[model samples]
Target: MNQTHLATLLAVLEEGSFDAAADVLGISPSAVSQRIKALESDIGRVLVRRSSPVVATESGEVLAQAARRMALLQAETDVALRRTIARVPLSIAINADSLATWFQPVFSEVAKWDNATLRLRIEDESRSMMLLRRGDCLGAITTEATAVQGCEVRHLGVLRYRAMASPALRDAYTDRTGTIDWAHMPTLRYGPNDKLQTNDLDGRLEGKPVNRRVSEIPSSEAFLEAARRGLGWALVAELQGRELVESGDLVLLDDIVSDVHLYWQYWRLESTMLHDLTAAVVTAAAEALD
Candidate 1:
């Protein structure tokens, strides 16, 4: 119920320790503990679980989210009144591929704002929405079109991918009859979370045994480079792979195109900064995605 206590709870969760949060808040560790205790007592529920690095309980998480939203709103109001306020970080989650390609423009847009800062958490598109549910980020670029509770959703567009490999790799896997030996060919995936490569190839096998010869390359640029250098075939984003395809560096393994429909999901708060960011993301997706 107390605004100060709520802020303290949010700070503890973000900083990961009571002492660390105390330093950020310019207060003693004792004061921080007292506030958290007062908050828990007021709510008649334990808000934070005392640990080496304190973690919020399920009920605590709900309050932490509310606290974070309140902080953002207060920061906005301070700026509107021409008061000097510390830069507020707008945390967002995005996939590695999107960061390297269509999402670049969003960074450029954020650079122009003086009152806000960007804190990015790179996760797979499929899992990025988890950050939203956990209140780890204010917004995310995700594969899920369905809105999370207290959030809004917008369909960006499809990011088309092509199954591609080096000419040598393709030739080595192709038989004299022109049928490709997909079951034996090596493949690359961004990481364990990345299913694009395996999903596409597995669909072709139709219950047959798969090669299981897969390499994990986590970085987006490195993943593309590995495929280009003949490490393995992979599903490459069209925007990132087009030049390589044209330059004869990478060849298409098949004509089937994978279309991943992307969406923008954010807290349904009436914040100008969030609105502006959504607009920027929508505009950039329009130009880069299908």
Candidate 2:
């Protein structure tokens, strides 16, 4: 396989268009298209779908991942040989809750490294595996225990969630018998991707879930803030909401807890940067997660 063609494929996928990729490569759009055509002819597979934002076909994904690994290894070699003063980019995906809690220490550790830099994609743990498959990120902190194809997986501990609400809101919705109004009380969610609050509610309620009053608060900080301000109740991460629960700012709705087991999935490559990062993540998770 031609290295130039592989690099062009990656550039098109990353930049989202042939023209954008051509500009980055300092070549004409026709030259970029010709290279892609030549590569497809050589491989006998349709590698790219030329849509509004160009996307990879199934076959393209395999080659794209190969190209990404080659680039990273080349970059690592360059840095190690002091051939260039460039920092090797270590791209990965992490969930919002983990980012707000245990993942903080990983940032501090990365800051001490001068030869590498981070390219983080903030995504939901349940859905980040797609990024890994597309080779958009080299690794991900995901809820999935099974490894993505061509990737290795390690079990990080579970992140526990507690359904919580403000004291005033809980009292306002509680009835005379002390049975909380699960059906009528408003609920907060991080986004459409978030299922923790809904799953918790459905398990506790009898028939027909709550009257579906939900407000979307996508940011981790704001999600907790909405619960604290009585906007709506939400399933908050234990590490993030423990102090609030202790301070009487938020109260648990029930004793039931939602435990999401997390895992680290990364390309099975022998690279020092990845090794150091995995060590840092495992160490932090051991201390923070149950």
Model 2 superposed RMSD (Cα) = 1.9
- Give one digit per residue, the lDDT tens place, for model 2 in 194-225: 87776777866766745678899989998999
Estimate the Cα RMSD of every predicted model relative to the unseen true structure.
2.1, 1.9
TM-score winner among the candidates?
2
* Cα-based lDDT for every prediction: 0.90, 0.90
Q: Cα deviation in Å at residue 238, candidate 1?
A: 0.5
Provide the TM-score for each candidate, comma-separated: 0.91, 0.92
Superposition error at 61 for model 1 (Å): 1.6
Per-candidate clashes, comma-separated = 0, 0
